[model samples]
Target: MEERVILGTERDFEAFAAAFSRRLHAGDVVALSGPLGSGKTAFVRAVVRCLHGADQSYSPTFTFWHRYEGTPAIDHIDLFRIDDPRESAELGLEEALDGSSIVLVEWWRNAPELVAERRYEIEIEGSGNGPRVVSVRRVT
Candidate 1:
């Protein structure tokens, strides 16, 4: 398990994502825990951008999942509207937990069981001046 504290600005988040990208292996699962309007999607964008060397678009907040054919391939999932954990299984969410891709799950508390045994959790809290406080934790 590894962890770090990162800044809240877009650029700082991007830099943090880039640095984290270096340590990612194929079966990496990152669980993002934050309230609405947090920078989960923004941070994911930076990661996908770093992996592909090009810009990827927004999160599939409504559709629930977005796939990016980046250098390492990334699957971004937002479970905000999901009301039940079992619905995740019906939605094929388990497919996202593959060993060949990098998966980032936002609002991951919705379906905690979907997360891998070894995963990274990023918690974002409100800081003064409208910035964010990000805390990274990895399961042991």
Candidate 2:
């Protein structure tokens, strides 16, 4: 089953993310997808803050990956620059899925293979001008 919510503002999105954090744990994978300016990074930032009590999350667009320290740690990855699954493997993504930390991936469509059975799939739909419809689903 999927849970859907409409976030009318940034605060609402953050609150949603904060609450969603409780459902996550080590070895889990989260896949986020949305268009530019659709609040994907913001949602992730909130989740990181809620989990670690500090805002250490950032968009891995240019860097490709960012690792955060927490109870179980977090590996944030952005596959926007990757051309294919082969390139994703070249980035050590396979090793990152060793079930030691939580992995949150952006632009997951570019590397669907990285998403495992026990994963959370989040999709945000909007242009940042109004309320965005966010859908959260367990992908197992």
RMSD (Cα, Å) for all candidates, in order, is: 2.6, 2.3
Clashes of each: 0, 0
lDDT of 2: 0.84
How far off is model 1, as Cα RMSD?
Answer: 2.6
Computed on alpha carbons, the lDDT of every model, listed in order, comes to 0.78, 0.84
**Residue 105's lDDT in candidate 2:** 90
The TM-scores of all predictions, comma-separated, are 0.86, 0.91
Expressed as tens digits, the lDDT of each residue in 1-140 for candidate 1 is 44556575767767887877777777899998877777888778878878877756644634889877655668888889888998888777655676778999998889888888888888877644476777888785
Q: Which stretches of candidate 2 lie over 4 Å from their true place?
A: 55-62
> After superposition, which runs of candidate 1 have C-alpha atoms over 4 Å from their true positions?
1-8, 57-62, 127-129
lDDT of 2 by residue, 22-99 (tens): 888889999999998897877878888988887465435348887776778878887888887778777876656888
**Which candidate number would show the highest lDDT if scored against the true structure?**
2
TM-score of model 1 vs. true structure: 0.86
Question: How does model 2 score by TM-score?
Answer: 0.91
Show pairs that collide, candidate 2. none
